[model samples]
Target: MFGRSKPLELNVLVLRDADVIATALRTALAAAAPEERPGLERAAALVEQAAAVPDAALRARWVHERLTAAGHEGPVDSVRAVKTLRESVPGLGLLSAVQLTKDAAAHRP
Candidate 1:
């Protein structure tokens, strides 16, 4: 009689929380001004596209660009938004990005 075979298992990796991000984006869209809603929606699309990439750096860059572009009015609002987003996402790059924005705003005339 042959010995019993052992069962095999596979491991899976989670990249990002798309649902959480989507919910956050929806909240942002709802809170946005009528004129700003379009831009915010566009930014959300950029984030969704970035999520497809497996590399963290690339994803961070995409997020950074969208946030930077959306930050046209004031640094304080931008900083707050970035901080809130960082909390939801959780990453060093995001922290640095928010810090850099704050630093730039501080030095501006």
Candidate 2:
């Protein structure tokens, strides 16, 4: 019989189309000068295929993981924008985040 295990409690955030992000990261890594792309390709695939987690904390964690794979693990102050929006308008920040992404995509060069 297998031993019992403690359930991991995670605040899962539903990130829509995270695989796309992962895919982009992979492409960027492949094109980059360096060749030690450890988790970049997998990260890209995750971003491109992972389902929306339905939790802010989880979403943030996913972002953090991907960002880490992309060689970023410092100064997440800018990434922690949800607290500001939540403080001002509760859960409205989620919509704000989505809208911002939409706007950015629409205006992408």
Against the true structure, whose lDDT is highest?
A: 1
Name the weakest run of 10 consecutive residues (lDDT summed) in model 1: 5-14
lDDT of each: 0.58, 0.48
State every prediction's TM-score relative to the real structure. 0.35, 0.26
Reference-based lDDT, residue 71, model 2: 57
Write down the lDDT that model 1 would get.
0.58
Per-residue lDDT tens digits for candidate 2, residues 1-109, read 5999655433223636565666668678967665546566656556544454434445445444443455544443344433432344344445554443333333322
Per-residue lDDT of model 1, residues 1-109, tens digit only: 5999654431223367765787799899999999989988987897788576654444444444545555534343275656654554455355455654454444432
Indicate the residue-level lDDT of 7 in model 1.
47
Worst 10 residues of 2 by lDDT: 100-109
